[model samples]
Target: MNQENRAGQWSRARQVASPNQDARPHGEVSLLLLHAISLPPGQFSGDAIEALFTNRLDPNEHPFFAEIDHLRVSAHLLIRRDGECIQFVDSDQRAWHAGRSYWWDSALNAWRSKLNDFSVGIELEGDDCTPFTKAQYTSLVDAVGWLMARYPALTPQRITSHAKVAPLRKTDPGPAFDWAYFRQRLSQAAFKQ
Candidate 1:
């Protein structure tokens, strides 16, 4: 891992940064939001999704993007189907992918936390029913390990699927993502460390 290059935080090639980001709130990087996306909902293997994050999506280029043309969003990282990891936002920064989301925090009532401010968002290339490839899982584990190593405050409990955080509005890293398998992977990684 190239410690100097934050881009090396993941195991794949790095892409252009998204402008839709800001500083983490209260310097609290305590949560990890897992998500999934495909350019045309179910299609894969295209640069359209990457372009969208960088604010360069050509609406007319694809009919599926037409509806979301006016919307702007971004995540900290995206793990392609083949497990190619791309970083759109830095760990120290906040990504704008999560909107109107909340997570449990015993100290606060109706705790509303800005996704960008309190958590790191990672988008996988898949749909609701699609099973994530083994490579993607391996890559996700590695990426999360890197982040946890860099930020001592991050932990497995902090990691959660998009559905868990925004149950009413979003669902990704879906049901097929087998939380137990990944949780075991994380525990093994932590043990190894």
Candidate 2:
């Protein structure tokens, strides 16, 4: 993959624009939020996730989809189970990923609310109870390394999980995610960059 970000879009990811994005209030991009998702909760490899992000998901397709199809949400990128990356929103724009969330920004030395204003959200194709694939980790590290290089404000310490940002409302990139391993891979990739 090319280790560069142009026009807020990564060359490695397949471009799939979603209408659920808009301009950032302050054009700030600092935090990297990681999340987990699956179409039918645990099922993988389906167009349901894409459809949902694009506001094209048919609620009648599934009982669970019927409940969440009305909600508008989109992440900056999504890493599939096979390690394919898809971009739903440009990095320069604000994606509707984080809802009612907050994070502690050590750089600012204070709690920052409304994470979407300055965060890039990445969705890994998996559920809370399942482990992410090695390919996903590798792709994520590469993507994050490029992002960190492109955005000077982003740091390894600033990278966080959605669960931490929205503790009571969300639990994703959950217990099954290997933060230590991810950090190790990211460090290695950053060193190479």
Best candidate (score: TM-score)? 2
Q: On residues 8-41, what C-alpha lDDT tens digit does candidate 1 reach at each position?
A: 3454547668888877768777788899899888
Inter-residue clash pairs, candidate 2? none
lDDT of 2 at 180: 96
**Residue runs of model 2 more than 4 Å from their true location after superposition:** 1-5
- Model 1 residue 152 CA deviation (Å) reads 1.8
Error of 1 at 60 (Å): 1.1
Local distance difference test scores for all models = 0.81, 0.93
TM-scores for every candidate against the unseen true structure = 0.90, 0.96
Query: Of the candidates shown, which would achieve the greatest lDDT relative to the real structure?
Result: 2
Which stretches in model 1 have alpha-carbon errors above 4 Å?
1-13, 107-110
